[model samples]
Target: MKVLAARRRDAEDIRFLIDHLGLTNAEQVLALCGKVFPEEEMPGRARLVLGDIFDDS
Candidate 1:
């Protein structure tokens, strides 16, 4: 998947996150995806099913 989040954070040579501002969790991200791909709500659900990622995950 290629999520072009509004913000991103990385370390020395490692990527941390590619996330949207104010949408920090699974539910919020899912909702945003729903808007971007309304016809494929099923695929959006898959993203929700994938769960969340954190700074220390």
Candidate 2:
């Protein structure tokens, strides 16, 4: 439904930001995630996922 579609769009937007914006740390991910999915509490989760997806180390 509409909610699912919006989620898909948000996922795509997140991927685009990850690929293009050079996010270098979990803090950056937390900031962007807060803006992107403000309804959710996601800082810890965001840090975990960001480690999996983006590791400059």
Candidate 3:
């Protein structure tokens, strides 16, 4: 899966979650959006969109 973070900080947070939390893939990391920002509101929510590099299918 692909993640679309608004800012560099958010990207860093996502990476941390993935590494520290032992998330298997991008999808899992995206699921922790709320956990990352529980109290404060997140201006721009990150998107976990997938992309295709080549048309192999």
Q: Which ten residues in a row have the lowest lDDT in candidate 1?
A: 6-15
Which 10 residues in a row give candidate 3 its minimum summed lDDT?
48-57
Predicted structure 2: lDDT:
0.54
Number of backbone-clashing residue pairs for each candidate, in the order shown = 0, 0, 0
Provide the lDDT at 6 for model 3.
49
TM-score of each: 0.43, 0.47, 0.38
Report lDDT (CA) for all predictions: 0.41, 0.54, 0.44
1-57 in candidate 1: lDDT tens per residue? 233232223221122322325445655655666687776534543442334343333
Local accuracy of candidate 3 as per-residue lDDT tens digits, 1-57: 113444544555445545676766544544565566566443434442211111111
- 1 or 2, greater by lDDT: 2
Clashing pairs in 1: none
- Superposition TM-score, candidate 3 onto the true structure: 0.38
Cα lDDT of candidate 3 equals 0.44
Looking at candidate 2, the ten consecutive residues that score lowest on lDDT are 1-10
How do these models rank on lDDT, best leading?
A: 2, 3, 1
Which of the two candidates, 1 or 3, achieves a greater lDDT against the reference?
3
Query: Any residue pairs clashing in model 2, and if so which?
Result: none
**Candidate number with greatest TM-score:** 2
Please, what are the lDDT tens digits per residue for candidate 2 over residues 1-57? 111133433544555566677867657767766787788766344445455555534
